[model samples]
Target: MELVSEHVANWTGVRLFQQALRAAGGHRFPALPAALPDANGGSLPADRAAVVLAELDAFAGTARITDEVELIDEATGRVLMQYVESYRGVFMFGPGFQAGVHPEGFFVLDRADPPVTLFRAARFGQRALPGDRVEFTVGGTRTVVAMRPVGEHGEPPPERLAVRTRSRSGGDFAYVVEPLRRLCAASVATGNPVMWC
Candidate 1:
């Protein structure tokens, strides 16, 4: 059987393929890489769920993968590799794979860009902003693993706080501003890095 389109339109393979391809060399097809384990049992590394998709702009003989790329035919249960046209050049799905060919860590999602929901935020019915970096897990079909924001360290966003500046005598200091208060509103100090009150 042949699919005229060269694009493998699925998420299962794209997330896994890119990783293996990069590590194993560009031309060499990589065996599916195992998903790294996280707190939620085991899921794809939240940091590396790259949606490698491009517009099907003016091109030929290569179709862009909009979502996931699968190796097996769901109906026939046969491994498949379809060559189709895409924006990035020839995109081949597979030469047909075995049942167990699926690589671990391939998290399936309904949409390419999953909603950003930190464990803490999800509890409050809040999602991450469009540009906020988030990671997640996929528990089942079209299931989303509530995303976990990444690259975040040290106390959550700052609020009200009290501080004291170093003072010796009754000095007529022009102003005193606490740098630790990230939310503190202060004007720039005339000569010092200190924010003038």
Candidate 2:
């Protein structure tokens, strides 16, 4: 399915969050895996589903407390659970967990039969500011440039932008890179053009 959003999104995280959205609205996502490993080195098929569902309900209720979702560490056979304060509709899953959606900045993905992927380090000659963004397009044969903010420069950034900046400044650049990397990898794996704007 084509996932459309005006904000930055992780491919898998967005899909999972979409499922949670549906579940929070009183619908179950049967597409969820039939089973997920638990911290006890034992699989908890039923409990996993229950925990996810319950958490969705709680999220919908705007509850402050988050119950632990028993999931096993993929690399280490240990329990992993934690809560992250959400910002800009982005709910960051705790460490070692890969199931949360973050919406920040903006990028549009245009699908192409065979996408072109490019990776290059930013070349800064001392003029590059922290707020400067690198414009990139993933799938298209042509370049795309985004327009600057319409308002005056002194104005504060939008809340979403502020949150995103905080996230990046807090050494969470990996969170942003991980999603983009996943998108690029997906394009490479599927032989499809993944456009970014």
The number of the candidate with the highest lDDT is 2
User: Model 2, residue 131: what's the lDDT?
Assistant: 46
Give the lDDT of residue 163 in candidate 1: 16
Steric collisions counted per model = 18, 3
Over 1-197, each residue of candidate 2 has an lDDT whose tens digit, in order, gives 43321233544334434333343344342422232221123322333434434433334344221222222222333322221323222232222221221232222222234522222111101111244322333333323222222111464322111112111111222343344344444444555443444
Give each model's whole-structure lDDT.
Answer: 0.22, 0.30
For each candidate, what TM-score against the reference?
0.15, 0.18
Q: Once model 2 is optimally superposed onto the true structure by TM-score, how far is the C-alpha of residue 95 displaced, in angstroms?
A: 35
Model 2 global lDDT (CA atoms, 0 to 1): 0.30
Off by over 4 Å in 1: 1-3, 26-197
Candidate 2 has its poorest 10 consecutive residues by lDDT at 120-129
